[model samples]
Target: MSESKPGFRPAMTWLHSWAGLVLGLLLMTIWWTGTLSVFDKEIDRWMQPETRIAAPEQRISADAIVERVLTERPDGTLSSLLIYLPEERVPFYEVHAEFENAESYRGRLHPGTGEELGDEVSLAASGFLYPMHYRLHSGAVGYIAVALATFMMMVLLVTGVVIHRKIFTDFFTFRANRKSRRSTLDLHNVTGTIFLPFHFLICLSGFAIFAGWYASIPLSFVQLADPENRAVELFYAADNDAYYSREAAGEPAEMLAMAPMVAQAETIWRDRYGVEAKADRIDVTHYGDANAVVEVRRHFPSNRTEAHRDSINFDGATGAVLTNFEASPLRKTRTWLEGFHQVRFDHWPIRWLYLVAGLSGCVLIGTGFLFWAASRRRKEAAQPFKVRLVDTIAVGSITGLVLATGAFLVVNRVLPLDAAALGIERAGLEVRCFFYVWLLTFVHAAIRKQRAWMEQCRAIAVLAVSAVALNWLTTGDHLLAAIGKDLWPIVGVDLSLLSTALIAALAAGRLRSKMRQVEEAAVATHRRDMGSPSGAAGTVANRAE
Candidate 1:
């Protein structure tokens, strides 16, 4: 409500604090989910344990999987089909298809046998945390909101750097044992300063990936010059010509085998690029139509910079190469930026680094909220309504979300496989359980006030430990068993859950101790004031005299 000082730095500082405070919670949710999405596939394997097949020495037949999918579809009415080949990390072949009425089906098959893998009603990675990270599961509206948050994040990062007088010095400074407010501020500064470049580029690249939706000027101009519906078509166009459709040839024709087409694609990649690239995914469009096309996308090697760009399309009938989508210089730059942001090159070490950077951002935003609340606590004592609201929201958003996620994982294990007997889908029940727990945390926070942080932290600790316990109870796959079986993904997820519980427990203990210290300090101040010569009791006696 007050004007900032008449200086650039002061203006930036004001912007940094207020802007961050307004959107910091949403940013934290996005970052937290995005961090989890870095390991979405691993989590998928952990959740859908039936898909945990051992990789075979010889690759399975793609033709057999395609034939099986076609036979399994309802009356052979296929709109489009995608087959994700099995690899060492993901050892199950996956087939996904769309129907005429926008309905879709997905199934996993054993790499060695082409038999169905899991009947468990699982959303796997795509249905759970991955979608939340990108779109918050709210479709178009959520996408716009996430993009706006990313833009504001960029603004906050830039303004934070501009306002900090000793950015470089702060990067090397942290005083954890100092007073609460000072320690919180130092952490905020250190995290923001140390990971500034990574944070900046990740935000910028995320915005650039969806630039047409948010920054519409360039797209608007292109729309004016293009056909009326061409703008919409170009907006949804894929890298290849797979989306194009043609009328049925009026005669049903058996499709060509996919194994030869896959082998040919690999040969082409080796011959043209001089690299032994494997086709990770194969997409077939208009499967029975004469104009059907097959698109084979190469899996980028970890050493390659251009990861998502290499793909070859072929005529489904003749198995002849149709087109190889090669990136231009600008497109290549964009691809590299996205690849870096998404970390799809399959490097675990780099992925872990991304997770660390993302968590640091979370800490930075969290401490910023704490610093704001703590700095205003004394001044706003008389009318502490706003401070209390922020404190409640801070606890609800940060620790509450963690608690809710743990509940979700636990519910995933606890819910019956046929949850439909209760007229609720198992996957939907898991999601509902998450929201219910999260909403309850806000209610608890309002009721408990300042104690909510400790309460929620303790709740999170309990829920996290319970999640791991439930996994063991339901699957009989404890960390030790998972490790013995060489199921690193499950082992990692179980260990991570236990580690989270430990951290939450420690945090709860720290908060309890701090609360005691604060109570003692307040009592000491009160006793000293009451015993003073001109204190409340002394003033009353003097007045009576």
Candidate 2:
């Protein structure tokens, strides 16, 4: 076997294994967390019980919310504010207002409860968590990690295809109760093999998400212009919202009423696009000047969707049409791309599909970690404890993250809203709870035997189930109620959590049972070799002898 000689295929195999092993855990965390992030809004709904309002609550118009903000904080620079209209998925429109200063407060008022709606805005942990999968909080470092992990992922997919020669032939093969190596191989093959299409599409599209950064291998032409402008041109922004400076021709500024303006906007949208656009906010630029323009953007479908979408710009003085930025093929295409990558416009089916593919990616990376440990265990058994500790860390992070995320949802439902509101913001508190609990899981696993793996998995199972129950307790909204009310998202979220819990419970049970069987087999093998009747000291003495 000329060990010193380098071989072609062997070198490729080494490249594949090491590349995958190094980035495997990070990729798994990213994928798993990203999957949950699709339902981030629903998760927040489940978390903040007060956000759920009875059917009779007053409906606040987007114009009114804007007026209120302008009234109370006239000096505060409006960075961004989203007013969500009530719907089955999100039964209340959330008005999120942020000022220029980072120390500003954001509140989610009952879309119906207009002025002085003082409910504390809960931490959008799911919102924050989803983005962390790609761009973590550490500006450059976050993107760097995502960039490195993505590069490794692409390598893994390529090398994985290379190593598995019979990719299509073994697509449906799975052996659950076989030898450990065989079982691991089946896991690697089954999860990795079946989802090749999904893996390819998501990875390809994900790179496209940051196309301005990496897809530049071919777009050097654009780079020749300003490198930064290339990115801006791909994604667009308005020129400016500055008012046209001119004194109001103080003649009773005959202008369009709010209701009539909406009616006019709808007529314009329906005439051009054959559908009424959901008007979110109406902005009057240069309120009284001749250059004044009023813009109304559709707000009914969440900000993430692309349909029933249009924007109407009008002359403030004449109410005559200025411009329209909706229903255009080009605008719609951009909307679809943004919606596809973000799952912003997705219904339950596509959301679940994304979740499955994402989880499968996580599984694929997880198996790579197991394969690494299996390859190293024999050598590591002879080395110092630290070598084995690194192995434990790999296992701990992948499994512990699952456990922590499940626990965080459970806490979301159980923790008092007021507790989160005090001193620390609810969002920040929720994040702390997630990390602290996750940290605890790692600490427990590191100290306990490998058996801790099963214990922690069981904990995850319980926490997940608890999250479902907590949702019911807080919202009086069980899965049944959700379905009855046509709340597919609510039903989907709960059922998904329950399904995860059941899967964890089964996996943990199987793992524990198998570990017991392995321990028993070791005992029986020792007895046979020693030929001793005394099972305790006699067995030890035989091994010593």
Best by TM-score: 1
Candidate 2 residue 79 Cα shift, in angstroms, is 10
Candidate 2's residue-wise lDDT over 277-384, tens digit each? 446555555443556566666633443444334567777667777676654565456445545656755376777777787787777877777766665664454553
Task: Give candidate 1 misplaced runs (Cα > 4 Å).
Answer: 1-6, 71-79, 98-104, 215-247, 299-306, 524-545
What are the TM-scores, per candidate, against the unseen true structure?
Answer: 0.89, 0.77
Against the unseen true structure, what C-alpha lDDT does each candidate score? 0.77, 0.65
**lDDT at residue 183 of model 1 (Cα atoms):** 86
Over 435-526, each residue of candidate 1 has an lDDT whose tens digit, in order, gives 89988988888888778889899988898888788888888888888888788888878888888899999999998887776666555655
Q: Worst ten-residue run, lDDT, model 1?
A: 536-545
For candidate 2, the 10 contiguous residues with the lowest summed lDDT are 236-245
Question: Residue 38 error for model 2, in Å?
Answer: 2.1
For candidate 2, the per-residue lDDT at 131 reads 72
